[model samples]
Target: MMTQNLLVELLVEELPPKSLKQLGQSFAQLLAASLEAQGLMNQNAVVTAFATPRRLAVHIGNVAAQAADKAITQKLMPVKVGLDAQRQATPPLLKKLASLGADASVVPQLKRELDGKTETLFWDSIATGTSLTDGLQKALQETITQLPISKVMTYQLADGWQSVNFVRPVHALVALHGADIVPINILGLQAGRETQGHRFAAKVNPIALHNADSYAQQLSTEGAVIASFAERRAEITRQLTSAASQEQLTLIDDDALLDEVTALVEHPNVLIGKFDAAFLQVPQECLILTMKANQKYFPLLDAQGKLANKFLLVSNIRPIDPAQVIAGNERVVRSRLADAKFFFDQDRKKTLASRVPELDKVVYHNKLGSQGLRMHYVRAIAKMIGEQLGGDALANQAYEAATLAKADLLTDMVGEFPELQGIMGRYYAQHEGLDDDIALAIEDHYKPRFAGDELPCKPIGVCVALADKLATLVDMFNIGEFPTGDKDPFALRRHALGIIRILLEKKLPLKLDELIQQAIKIINDDAILQQWENSSNSSEGIAVRRMALTLTNHAYIAEEVPVLHKKLQEFIYERLAGSLREQGYTAQEVDAVLGLDPPLPLILKDILKRLVAVRAFAILPEAISLAAANKRVGNILKKAKTEGFDNLSLEELSLHLRSDPQEPAEQKLYNALIDISDITNTALSTDDYVTFLQAQAALKLPIDDFFDYVMVNVEDKVLRNRRLTLLANLHSLMNRIADLSKLAT
Candidate 1:
């Protein structure tokens, strides 16, 4: 009954930088999980993951040398079927027992159990535990098989005849239990205690691990490698901060860049490097992007949050005279900056306005014409949104911005770095000396591109962003390119979420349905529609032509818009609810607010207000009873309506219910409803949901009394209809803000 710690490491060629962290974490977790599943490790075992430029390793504690034996009971067959009339061993039972490595002699010891109506015979035995060597080997194979490798590299082992596929070329494999080597093999390498250390900085060559618990410490001291990804990242962060502070500058923090750098180096040496001040003449965004994306350097920012000439470099080696390393990084970065500056300078020779026509050569989608046609649609939608949000001036700016938005797609800089598409447009726009709003809008149109990202800063940017996203959504959805499950190839979900964020966060008063219709209408226009229909017909350098078709001729857009619009609305609302839930709203609260189906000013901000109001209302003392009563009212009305009751409109439903004295409880409830109706109407008109809900508190008592003393399904047909109308009226009053029935327990 002894336990030991375990260590496992896979030495490999330089792993993929972006995938190293994922590969390491997955390998460690899966290996430990498989061991725990095999009963070799307990649930509470301590597990640590280690990853560097060339290795993935794990150290686990409280792993048993062999898993404990397990008692198992397996049902065989019914007693009557397995045995003859006298209960002697039958051939089938004997064969089954023999197949289980048992004999007829053991038949008398079999247990009897009832399986449904049949009495079944079962065999109970102890399943021998798996030894650590066998368990670890199985777990290691599984871990390697399941690594999250984006692509695999195939290479020959030392034999140069047999091949193995892995994320990188495998060099060695090490597995240790306590202080003893656990014999296992993977990727053509036998597990041993020896592992490679840092390429040039190891204190000891072929570092030999002493024990499972000493892996990380020994690796760091003898290998000159910081094995833990988290620790290495933290150390780099500390170095960057210290270096940045000494120079009175800030490092632009990026987690992705940090992780990649962590994966690229075993020991990080943060050095300060400087570029020519003239590179700042090009937009800071371009320089910063080039430095970080190409060179993995953290650009330092000035006090005003502008990119400084100096940047921080995370070198894998610490040199004796660091000046040469700093110079080398500076030399390499200058060349990259020069390329960015050249692209910027060359792009300015032809203005963004001039590049507009060049977009015709670029296809937006196979079904949706070129970028030119898309911009045309975008301009139209932008003008519409701008006109709705502002007036002629804003509309004009939005139209201008939308027209030039995709021009950067043709630029050399954007061609080299696609991530700079919108950003480079902004620089070119400024070079063209267009209005500040137009230039900013060009870049900001793609804002809030990811979760927690900032939205467009100005009104013009907001208008253009909304228009661009809607155009994409409407056009893609029209072509039956809607997202299914997780396959949002066109990023329709991101576009949808962007639209929702803009509407709610910007507090735009434009109606969601109306905006979608406007977007669809833009696509349905004669020029854009005909161009799209004839787009794919053209070959290289040939003008595609269609027979000047009307909107009806393009059956795709015409047929798809109405259905797509309805779906788009639902998709947006669902995204909103999900976003709200992420912000800590409960499912019930979100459902209550969403259930209201409040119309037109269906602004995201407005929906959020209703959600907040509903959450507050749920805490009131009368909430439970009101919600329950409302649920009852809804069910009764729904059943009556389904049963072919005279289903009147809200106004018509109320007119049929009278305050008849024949039923005193109904009469009392009718009077209370009349009073509550006015208050609810006023509160709803002003969007004061809390006030509307509180106003219904008066009807709770009368409602309870009505339900207690009265039967809604009275035999008289007229009476039943009348009672149904009363309940419908009550249902409408309670649900002005939300479907209270959804909140019922």
Candidate 2:
């Protein structure tokens, strides 16, 4: 088989910057995967992805001109159904062979094999290799079809009557095998060697690629474009660093922003721009966000990590003078910063407390009433959590923070930039001479907005943060807005994970079930319901009134609260299981710890200790035998219960054991359990799970002997019941730390 490097490119209108990186990587991977599946490319072939604002391309090394032929064996029908009494092919066999392009002459060549007690016939054939032209066409079509495009645009082709749907309108397609053009068509465009590049700065209008290997070099030399997304991003980073170093400042580090900028320009030329120093009076968050979100510029920071007056911008075209370009960017950014400053100044004119009344006009959810009503729920929950965690002082601070948390939604700064909701509240609170704890809590309550993000640093902040996330989870689950698959419009999974992270990482002595119950109670309180009813009736909007009525109706909440608690509990545990696995714990270890039932309250603070203890116990020499023994004992108890032993009290079942034990194995096991009872109880009382589990290793020999020499199902009813009760007690002692049976395998 002859092989050559392959290059493919699709030219179109400027692609979305945010999705360009993913789109390029997907295109290359999907194309290479398709070729590998078709046997036209090796599994280890090197695949390079190229993406810019206007194109997505890939270069795959060592793709064959045609795939190697493969030998295949396919199963036919069973011999009993296919062969006649005389060992001749039946009509069905003939039809099957005919469908496979075979005839009766080849019937003797069919192989016979046993397929689950019945002899089956097998047909062997050689499949022809796929030519590069056909393979590339199929791969290209499949890749385009599978691209992770969120939205597709439908547009008419040059023919005017024919239309095609794609992420953008197709302009040209390039496909090359070595130096030869592969004859492939996609999106109504035929493959060619010509492609347009660098709309304004290209040395040549249409750079004619000479071969597959020359694609990148030719684009750089003649097209005035850096085709590789990563390479372009590196150049921008290098230039930004060099420029910032010369000015004694550092650029704000944001990889997502860097990737977006890389996708926005083909030739990145980093240039310095400046804004008025007066704008620094506003919060640095406001200034940095305005620059990044609106103008896509990198805000420079000083030595102390404070925002500098200067910023860096990447330009698509490099000019010799560069003065006009720098001036133009400065002008645009100055206007944006001015707008941000104006919003900030206007917002602080009134304190956050004064803006609380306006939240009623803002609907949090149509079915959940207004933000004002939601605030009431959050304040109550926060105060409850604070009271539990701290004393009345922390509770008062949490209530104050929760009361004003959503007030910033009405501010000019937050209204213009919704991302600044809690941030502006913090700033406004500070301006009003509020306590530092309260101000910080207002901002930090939304802490851990995503995975691995920090939790609230203070007790008051932790309370409000927990309350906010819990309220969201309970309310969303109550309304049946449960997240299904990847469609988490309300981000319930994120909310659940946030709550789990806070509870576990903060080491707060809070029980998962308790917090959930408290949140449900607060939301369903009659006082809160009455408040919601009054607000809804006074509001002018009919939708608001109807939603409030639905929410206040006690019957709807009563039916949903129990289901919501169970579902939310399961959801949180599921997230915790996944998080634990990601942190490198084995599935068996996680399962054993998480498999506890209703008696256990799922104390988040102690889950890690339990998992650590389980991991340590798993490595013990006696762990496997004890785990298996536990499983056997469980089965015996379950059988005994099924045989009407369930109604017998432990005293009734163990009545004969008070006198004497008939079996030595049972006596040895019973004595061992008694010996370890005090030690295990002390260990458990101190929450020393490792010591508790380690103490059980002493029972391994006796437990194995009991299971081997003792017949638990003896015909003597009293003896059998006594053994069953002994096994039940052993099961309880063994599983106090974790379900050892999950580790049996």
Candidate 3:
């Protein structure tokens, strides 16, 4: 069976544990995918990975010893390019092919045959019995080295001139197949059988690897590290729940914090520690973030589910003095809480809205103007959005809230903890005696911080949130700062996504372009223009805003407002296309339909849905035939259009046909075209794409018969032209059914 197993470990100088777990899993998945692509796999082949702060390890079991040998490829082309007028291949070329281990033959061509028309084809299939180790090594080297490094450095080693670049300096690499070596190298480290353990558990010489199994055992016994994050997480959860039970407290479940906590420890030893009860005077959220984000601790709650004045920290190693570690973490956590409390106290001294005027001092972006300016634009935009959503009251409240929202950004609380931007706003707004809707909007503006996050449910919150984001986008467009690849410095992509998600989820009837225009107007208003013009900054801030706005509008190619409209369409189309694909529509189908239709996001979604549903029906053949018939006749009537259905078509169509006219075939095609036109117009009016596509599919039998029986390229030029025109008309109508040309049978 030639079964084998391989273990690989990558040692680095204290990699950020948060990134290491993701890196390890991604690396293993990529390696496994490459193995599968190379057609080398064992039935039971499985891959697993583990990471500590210092190292990432991967173990693959039940792997094949070698990839299967390559198969012979038969080349049907002749060996030589050209010969005599007879087009025969040269004997010398055929002979050369034989020398290269190719089998060659000269005979009559299968596709084309003529007098002395012959060819020689040479094909050689080489068997490649490459080992798993070689494949793994090559794959690992390329894949690992090509990581998207945000922060990294190239180091020239002490003894060698070879410079190696990594996020952190590579110290060692271990690769082994059982006890035998699996030779590989990456980031200048030779893979071997030894891997290190936790930094604190075995500081100097923790790893002494003899094999994979033995190394795993050594990690657990001597280093108190398991390497696997899943194991550590599970163990920590189990131990934490048990400890919390004894203390009669509930462990506050925070999945995001759990991930960070899991990354910080290798062998999770959950331990509880108490802070001074006086710290409970601080806001509960402040205490939680202090413990969670700062200390990587899980906060616990008492029986009443309130903060228990205690926290659980999952230590990587069972410390010789657990109290000392707890005390150190407690001291660190208390410092953060103390700072947070101080900010809160200072911020609460004034009303939240009173902080609004100060936002004018904080530059949202040096090019975009102050945070106060953005809030003004947001207030206007939110009110418009709120009016459209039929939440007039909510919208007014939200606009008020949006104005005060950035007020918190100017506060000491937000300056210290950017993550608490929205949270701080809500607390300060409520303390300032703002309405509930206004206070809620302050917090809800950041509702969908990520893809899976929830949208703002309250109408006022949604309005303000949309306004806040649109204002950001509009300003970016004004200042020429748009998202490029991973550099969404202002997170405009997220803003766009938030808008799309809100509309789709809330089913808001607001037009995307209209919404975008409102924000654009707010930015391009006379007041801002004057402010920008008056600014004495010699760097041409106002001029830059105009250029950026022009560029931003250019993001979309639209028929009316080319750039801005185009961007709106493009964003909607992309989202709809993505959503359609997720529903199982092939990309080509979605694109074809999209191309033929006006780029309205709502209409695009409808068409995509129709395409997806139509795929399930037995209409593929009909669609293909009808489309081909249309293409065949498109040129004939390229200059022609239907005059009117009121006029008698039988004689008119015959008049257009200069060549011989066969009665029934022409009539059939004409009738189908007429029916397709009706279906197209009907779908547009009613938006019933599903039914329209089926009606268009009805042309299958008639199109097939017309093509099979009629001679489109007839000897009579007039009749030929008429036939072409009819077919072209058919193709034109079929497009209304969702760009049938893109559907290939």
For candidate 1, the 10 contiguous residues with the lowest summed lDDT are: 541-550
Better-scoring candidate (lDDT), 2 or 3: 2
> For model 2, how does the per-residue alpha-carbon lDDT over 1-745 read when each residue is reduced to its tens digit?
7899999999999999999999999999999999999999999999999999999999999999999999999899999888999989999999998998889998898899998998999988888899999999999999999999999999999999899989999899999999999999999999999999799999996999999999999999999899999999999999999999999998889999999999999999999889889999999999999999999999999999999999999999999899999999888888888898888888878888888877777878877767887888899999999899888987888999999988888988888898987888889899989998888899999988888888888888899999999988877766667788889998888888888889999898999998998898788676766766575543544345346536654323567667667877888899989999998999999999998643478788799999999999999999999999888877777777777763345566445665766888988888899899899989989999999999999999999898779988888876777787788888988988889998998
Measured with C-alpha atoms, the lDDT of residue 615 in candidate 3 is 70
Rank the candidate models, highest TM-score first: 1, 2, 3
Sort the candidates on lDDT, descending order: 2, 1, 3
| Candidate 2, residue 340: lDDT | 89
All models, RMSD in angstroms: 3.2, 4.0, 8.7
lDDT of 1 by residue, 1-745 (tens): 6999999999999999998899889989999999999999988989999999899999999899999999999888999989999889899999898888888888888998899989999998889999999999999999888888889899999998999999899898889999999999988999899997889999998988898888889888998899999999999999999999999998887999999999999989999999899889988888988999999999999999998999999999988999999999999999999999999889889988888877877877655556776787799899988898889988988998999989999999999899998988988887778888999999999988898899999999999999999988876666566689979888888998999889988888877888887787776666754554465333332223122112323324456567767877888778878988998998998888776745444666787777877877788888899999988887787677678886455455445544344578887888898777778888878888788877877887898899899998988886787778778777777776777777789
Q: Give each model's whole-structure lDDT.
A: 0.85, 0.88, 0.68
* Candidate 2, superposed: residue stretches over 4 Å from native: 68-128, 532-561, 642-658, 661-665, 708-722
Cα TM-score of candidate 1: 0.93
lDDT of 3: 0.68
C-alpha RMSD of candidate 3? 8.7
Q: Which is the better candidate, 1 or 3, if ranked by TM-score?
A: 1
